[model samples]
Target: MIPWDLIKGGMRHHISEHMIICRPVSENTYFVLRLTLSYLSTQLTWEEM
Candidate 1:
């Protein structure tokens, strides 16, 4: 029989691992979106000038 504590610990570890993997991806996506938005804004301003 499996122990409840072991199952809980494994689930917790899995969740933490997923967060570790996803954290960088989400951060990179945010960074890219910010850069793209800034670039687009600059282009629009230049066209207006």
Candidate 2:
């Protein structure tokens, strides 16, 4: 799982709601990251089972 603290720390240093929404590329990257994390967690769960 991606740590909220790490995400928040990165955001604190170099991102904002405005920047995230304003840039198309950044928005895509964010979505990809979300999807990848979700997929990874699901796979991990299946492996445990």
Candidate 3:
């Protein structure tokens, strides 16, 4: 299982960085972003464990 605290901090940093690079996202882009984030979170959690 992943630790909540670590995910929150790291996720925030990643999101901020992403926002800086891509400020305007369309519907398809949003869907892709969601999928990417989900994949990233799962990978990060696994790596943490």
Most accurate candidate by TM-score: 1
lDDT of 1 by residue, 1-49 (tens): 8799999999999876875687878867777899999999999999999
- Tell how far residue 15 is off in model 3, in angstroms: 24
- TM of each candidate vs. truth: 0.55, 0.54, 0.46
lDDT string for model 3 (4-34, tens) is 9999999988887776677746645786889
How well is each residue in 1-49 modelled by candidate 2, as lDDT tens digits?
9799998988776756655667968777887899999999999999999
lDDT accuracy of residue 15 in candidate 2: 57
lDDT of 3 at 27: 44
Q: For each candidate, how many residue pairs have backbone atoms clashing (under 3 Å)? A: 0, 0, 0
Clashing pairs in 2: none
Error of 1 at 44 (Å): 0.2
The global C-alpha lDDT for each of the candidates, from Candidate 1 onward, is 0.87, 0.83, 0.84
Ordered from best to worst TM-score, the candidate numbers read 1, 2, 3
* Residue 49, model 2: Cα distance from true site in angstroms: 0.9
Clashing residue pairs in candidate 1 are none
